[model samples]
Target: MTTITFTVSVLCLLPQSALARWACVRACPAACTCTQEKSCSVLCDRSGLAELPKEFPCEASAISLEKNRLKFLSERAFGTLPSLKSLSLDHNNISFITPGAFKGLSNLLELKMAHNDYISYLHTRAFTGLKKLLRLDLSDCNLFSIPDRIFIEQTALKELLCFQNNFRRIPGAIRGMENLTHIYLERNKIEAVAYNSLLGLGSLRYLNLQENRINVIHDNAFQDLLRLENFYLNDNLLSDLPRLAFRGLARLKMLNLGGNQLTNVSKTWFGDLVELEVLYLDRNQLLNIEEGAFENLTSLITLHLNSNNLSTLPFSVFQPIYFLGHLYLFRNPWECDCSLDWLKQWMESYKLVRDIPCAAPPSLAGLDLSQVVFPAVNGTCVEPAELNLTTASSETTATTENRFNSLISKLLQQELREEMGNGTESLRNDTLLDSEEAQLAAGVGGRWTQSVQSLLCFTLTWLLFGPLHLSDAGFWLYCT
Candidate 1:
């Protein structure tokens, strides 16, 4: 009888152990993979799931439902995943998110819903329970504007990415999110930056508004972003800016204004950005930069001024930037003359200066300014006689005409030398002139005559009308 009783106890223990093993296997939802080796991680990605799967392991800390066919997220969709810290629903067809959709994800730290192009409407209370959410990605969505209170429960949120959307302006919903650090809104339709758009985001560090239609930025629009560091406004439609548009941003480091319609740089715009390091103003219509425009940027290290319509820069513009390391000045119509003599001297001390190709003074047309040696007369570098026509007196007009002819002769000689170097037979100066003078002389003389006449007309107009008309007439003349 004792042997039989012991055998029965062993049989009962076998069934109980098998039941426990079966329960463990059932904890993971169908077609989902779960692992509890480190922390319960559930992955149902690319599983053809049309809706959120139920019966996720109770201890699940991370879940991925990416690359699914989920269309709508109903209320309490992710029901009470108490230990859930991260959830990814990216690359799905999710369009609507009902109120309280994420109701039970209180401890959720990161949520990704990116690449959901159908997600246009978000209920105000959709993210009602994600209080501890630190990072939220809603990028590449069809969101035109977020509801004002959509982020009311995300007080601990730090990073928000809403790039590649149809947001016409900075959403008012993110105004008071003080703990927010980084905000990316690139590739949007945001037209203007109003004063109150970024009211209370004090802890913000990085803000990207690249590839937008931002034409107007109100003065003091960034007044509340005291701790802001990197600000990118490249590839916009900004032609002019308010004098004090960037006031109160003393801690800003990198400011990018590349690919815009800015005609000139203003001295008053960067008065408070003392700590700025990198500045990008490339790919614009910048014809002139006011003196002392970068005087306050003492700590600047990198400056990009390439791909503009600039013919020359003021000598004092870069004097204050003592720590400049990388200077990009290519693809500009740089006239290599006495005005740019200081740049050659400056380039000697900074070996990393990019090549600047000359665009004027036919003699140095295609030569790099850094490689061209300017002749010094009486211990001073003089502007080429051809470029000094604007100041030529009536008595010197005959001499100016002779110098212009000489310049043309020199250009022809240079072209003949290049041709001879390429194994073509060299021709006499008179022979070349007879053949090429009509073609080259007419083009060169017309340009210089037009330029001089325009310069004289501009000077006379400026003197007669004063500075009021300088904007319309004088600025363009000077730039061209």
Candidate 2:
């Protein structure tokens, strides 16, 4: 019999953004010199000016001087402005900033200086004057390392985003910035959070340590972070997380440990995180989760556990979560046996989950997930709809029977031989040979399996049960 073959064609409809905002094109403020229209803000793209315009004649709050051919900024390059909050100087040709270059724009809040040329030197106290700077984004700027003292005086700074810059370790200067709340140091060359590198940041809430080359964390590396809210350490070289790696983050809210080489979560992995809210552990080589690994996280709201090799979720694995909202558990090699029946209850309750992207077998890729993504599917699958006799008969119809008969005749002539007595003897000399022969005849089930088998068996038995004269008589009598 031919195998049940299927050709699946998937057409995933991507949902584009419905709220794509247009570029903000407000009239320029009366603050700086502009090369464009007096009404529109100037774009000094690749302009080879050594210094900025000292006096801007119109009203503009922001300036974008990206990819310019200026080597340095003169002192007092930025004139006094009553309302300038954002600055974009990314992808420029300059490497040095005079300590007094940004002297007058005290209202500046966000500065983006990403993707610039090699900035091998940053003078001391270069960014000491901005009192209202809240967000300093310096990603992808070229620097081998950073001095820690740049942030010593910016007390009002709340967010320090230095991702994708050149640095091999956590800057020790960041440890003393108490007003800092969130630090995104991912995609850097740092190997570890420096010892006491985060000691005094009492208000620091979120620290993203993802996509780095860190292999290990010294014990008590995070001992003094009492107010940290979220910590992400995914996509690193960590073979194992320390037993108490998160010991002092009592108020920690989220932790991501996916995309690593972690083997399993030791029972003491989450030592003191009582307020943890979300945990992502997918795309790791976790063979098993030890008991009590998540015992203390009563506040966890979401957990991701997709793309592992687990055949089942061990019992009491989620017993501690009474209010868990989403659980991602698909794409693993599940047996689809009675062992997975428990998934039905959790699936029935939650509305959102993880790894639904790779939910069903790729064979059923065309099937709509909304139709079969239910808790009852955790049980055994019903018989294939295409395999039922009535459906197959109706779907294939008369040609199916004709094809089966023709195929069987071809196979019989190729496999069965009357030449050698030994060959026929093997076919006929076995005990229960009659039953085996009947089974062989019945093997080619299709649209008309029973009818063709009946004809073949009746003809063989009629010839066997009577003489030629009697068989001819019986055949003629049956035809009549």
Candidate 3:
């Protein structure tokens, strides 16, 4: 009777708490197992199960019913999982979702449905009560149209990934998901987006319109997203960006315009984005950047202008991005002359490298460019025969600092303050771009000698000694 009293006390204490505890300790799925503490997880990856068993043995918190041969998700299929949170149904043959299929997935936060073959349409309210949902990924699913009313009632949606879909146009009056933050639309056939199609999305932060045939975007097209941060418009056919194209994006950060066939870009293109950082312009045919073209981008970081037909970069080239880091410039026809002397000095003062791969020709292809020196200023170093000897010594002797070394050392400091944010003294192994030193140009540099010899030949031809015979073979021997 005493022992029975103890057992009755435990049972009579509480009923609901005992039932909840029992649900976790039970054994589940034969092909899968759990630890003694009993944390249930389904690892049915790459399994060819046709249909979910009428009764799954163990209760799990996360389910992986992906990579199966299932054709349809029947009503109430996942209704019994009260604690399920994450579900991955990717790469499946699923073609249909009966109403009430996701009946009790209210606690779910992420749902992955990417890379499926036959999910043509979705049942209305299929994911009805998942109020805590944060991400819904349905990319590469061959979708054409989305029922705008499907997500009209969800209040907590944040990120939506729909890249690689065949959407020709967006639906009208898209539901006002006030808390939505990101929307991916890359690789779609979208021709246009209505001015108000993205209305009521005040929290949207990212909008990717890459790889689409989007030629026309009306003014105020993105007037709804006041807090947008990143916008990608690469690989499109845009001729121009309307003056007010980015009117409402005061907090915009990064903008990508590479791979487009644009012939022009103006200071006004970035007028409204005060906080914008990264800007890509690798392949467009930009003819000019007006002196003050980029004066407004104080927060700009890395600027890419590779693979273009740029003849020169203004001295104020770095005036806008005062805090800029990497300047990708390799393929352009860099005329190594007096005009580019500052670039040589700048490279050495900062000890920076030219990560640019010069594609000049077979003779100079793959030539490491950071070591090349621009011509002397006004041909001064070599013509004065008295100065020739010092310049010669400056080229070869120990302790002689070449223009390349000095320039990279000094400029690398300022560029680093801009590259790696403040207070970082330790640098990575990539400190110098391939460890090029200006010393190679200082000692016995054939190019410098050629300049001196030309000046001597013109001036000394009138001298009694006349011009000393110097073969082109000898000139080439000392330079490399």
Q: Which candidate number has the best TM-score?
A: 1
TM-score of each: 0.76, 0.63, 0.68
Candidate 3 local accuracy as lDDT? 0.66
Those runs of model 3 whose alpha carbons end farther than 4 Å from true positions after fitting are: 1-39, 56-59, 170-175, 334-342, 353-480
* Candidate 2 Cα deviation (angstroms), residue 36: 16
Tens-digit lDDT string for candidate 1 (211-290): 99999999889989999999999999999999988889999999999999999999899999999999999999999899
Best of the two (1, 3) by TM-score: 1
lDDT for each residue of candidate 3 in 1-480, tens digit (9 for 90 to 100)? 999999778767766545444544454455433332344565667667787756543356677777788788888786567667778888898888786677677777888888887987876666777778888888998788777677755578888888998888754424478888888889999887668767888888898989998787887788888989998988887767776677768898888888776666666767777787888887876656666657877887777777666655666755666447666665565434333445556666665437544444333355544654443447552222334456766555423334333543534453455345643344333354222232322332324344345434434432544222232344324333
RMSD of 2: 20.5
Ranking by lDDT: 1, 3, 2
Give per-residue lDDT, candidate 2, residue 25: 30
Q: After superposition, how far is residue 283 of candidate 1 from its true place, in Å?
A: 0.6
- Model 2 ranges off by over 4 Å: 1-50, 57-62, 79-84, 335-339, 348-480
| lDDT score of residue 85 within candidate 1 | 94
